[model samples]
Target: MPKKKKITPKQETALRCLQQNFDKRAELAPSSDDVHATISKSSPVDIDVDADELEKNIATLSINNGNTRIRYILCLDIEATFDGDKSFSHETHEVIELPCILADIKEGKIIDEFHTFVKPSLHPQLTNECIALTGITQVDVDNAPTFREAIQLLDGFMKKHSDKLHPPPQIGSPPPNGWPNLGPRNYVWVTDGHADIERFLCLRSCRINRVRLPAYISGGYIDMKLLFKTHFKERGFRRLPDMLAKWGLSFEGREHSGLQDARQVARIMLFMVQMEAVQLKCNRSIVMEMNLSFAARQL
Candidate 1:
């Protein structure tokens, strides 16, 4: 049997371009409702035969430059309350039972989220006060998957999304079977504070043998607690909440709901990206306008 050769980087890029062209072709087809609606938005005289030609031109441009290299961020936050007695005791330490939320953010908006409750194997019992504050009890953790399961699920989700980022195959060519050419993608998990990471590391009984999650997730994390202190020193910014308010946005929602908090964090980061893109576009337009004005002055 002959060994199949691996796809070179140039060939991989070509495959992506071909797939994008296929998507463009499908969009311009007559039966496509999306194509029809986009055509209706323009004037009748400018429509007709030019639409297909325009689509082909756009396809060429798309193939030449695709946004597949865009970064994807995994935002996460955890909510936990101290379990056991009301008073701090030397004999017993407050057991922290928590739920963690994970979200996938790209181009500044959160596209997917996962919420999971971690079963505190070491601290199985919960105090009444803790239950009231966190709304979590022994019953909740009884059947819930352990922290290890949650990590496995998270890893699987990342792999799935990495696969999804591929541009569809080009038209008229048989669909690139199950495996479309794959590429290296980034994964950065952000947490509200370092406590969540700390807690996971402290769990002695929990399954820690399989994967070293922290090392893999160290790429980019927007730690609000760390950012607040660093911002003041470097950028003269006061606090995260203050910065968010200045940007005309406010963070709201239940504090301990991991999913809700992760979503809010994703939204804030996405807003920053959107504003920067808009600013860049405006600056370009202003430069063009200034050049045109100077030309008119010469006339």
Candidate 2:
């Protein structure tokens, strides 16, 4: 057997953070401004620790000066198909499947999942290759909702969960929800990779006749694959199964199916959270880094 690589001190610290659940993760994030108070409640120091030292400790690992608020993460995935053409351009292909699961970052579980098959507008007929490749039957396409209808369903699903996360003064008719509230909301949308989003926008753009994609669609989503790549110092884009396997996780469910793929993305993410991989959100998605070697060089 090959020798295992030795874990470093930073990695050990990261591991400790995971063992403690996400409390440490929360300490470093922007939302927990009163981190010292919170941690004091969880694990009290026996000796009289100086207030300055406690503040110093919190400041060292903290992501910011403590301002922004992070709440939830929306893990999602998409599936698309192409006519038998080998050189199919994503520019031409449409979204045939879309699925998403809203995961509670603190609670550590999926609150809800949404998926819908989208009937193609241009091609309309699935090539034999498409059928075999995705295991999506022609009947699935024929009876499924249109791409526009899928968007409506997605909007509805987001509204449902958004209200659950932050309940309204009163629930009536879904009331156009608070997604547009430009302040740093505690929730973010995540995907296995970026191409899925690109394809989704491609199809949606065509339907909207070049109108701007919704802000929720454009800036709202994070490509989780990028997060993993940054964490492990990985180069180049990879398929979901390959990324999962690299992290010693087997695929959770059906590979190509959108919902299953989304679920797998969610599970792997939870695994990362468990491993104490730190996520810092400055503006876009949280950038998780493993700087074990870099920190060692500093010492």
Candidate 3:
């Protein structure tokens, strides 16, 4: 087995601050220059907590913070193909394969991730082009879990993992001053269409039969493609990658890879929330602030 590296205190501190900011962003708390400055200037505390313990602590802190409301936005992305013939039947534009990724976003940060490959039960074979493009083979699909099973596993994972951490309050909860916190938090789903979500919902409904997820998960999915088109027309940006570059943040790694793409989008969302808060000079605890180790990237 390979040696596991240890995390330093500096990295832990920075991660804590990141998580705090994410929570605050979820609640639309005003940006705090004081928090930013404090994080920037503070030296890392030399503590000896294990990385796993540190992460649990941070999650606890995020759940307990009452200063800013927080929410967990679960996002999924799917893979599909475009037929050369648009005038053909609807089935002609069918999806050859699919992969799903789930990201738990609090405030503006992605705090957790889940991913899985799905075999289309109805479509066992892939076109040669599809196989070449996605690198998914007919054997791969045949051996993979069915769409319904895949989503059920994902749902179970989401509930299990998310429940392990304390969840932030529902968005729009009354502030300490008793005022209704306002603003839409955009649960941006980067996908080809609503198929993934539809499948997820259908699977979830089948499992619970009647119990429904909260409205946050139930309604208003932000489609990146639509957002891109609108941005181009109104702001002259053509794509997500273009938008991120313009904002001075780069989406690293391959574009179409499911988990990588979800992680990239999650980061972009967090950055946007911070920028928005900073621009407005809002001082709310949009992020849970803490410090841990430099070595544990997960922490």
* TM-score against truth, every candidate: 0.49, 0.64, 0.49
- The numbered model that scores best in TM-score is 2
* Poorest lDDT segment (10 consecutive residues) of candidate 1: 280-289
Residues 6-93 of candidate 3 have per-residue lDDT tens digits of: 4456644544565565444345422222212222111111112211222223223222233544344444555543233434333423
Relative to the true structure, how large is the alpha-carbon lDDT of every model? 0.38, 0.51, 0.38
Preferred candidate (lDDT higher): 1 or 3 = 3
How much is the lDDT of residue 259 in candidate 3?
Answer: 50
TM-score for candidate 1, residues paired by index: 0.49
> For residue 85, what is the lDDT in candidate 1?
59
Native-referenced Cα lDDT, model 3: 0.38
Tens-place lDDT digits, model 1, residues 1-299: 11223555664454344334433432432321221122221111111111112111222212112333435545566544454556533223222333222223333334454555555545557667667766666676665555454444444444446554333211111122312222323333445555444343322322232222321332223454454334334444333344455344454555455555565555544443443231100000000010111000000
Clashing pairs in 1: 108-270
Clashes of each: 1, 2, 19
Q: What value of lDDT does candidate 1 attain over all alpha carbons?
A: 0.38
User: Which 10 successive residues of model 2 have the least lDDT summed?
Assistant: 290-299
Instruction: Using lDDT, rank the candidates from best to worst.
Output: 2, 3, 1
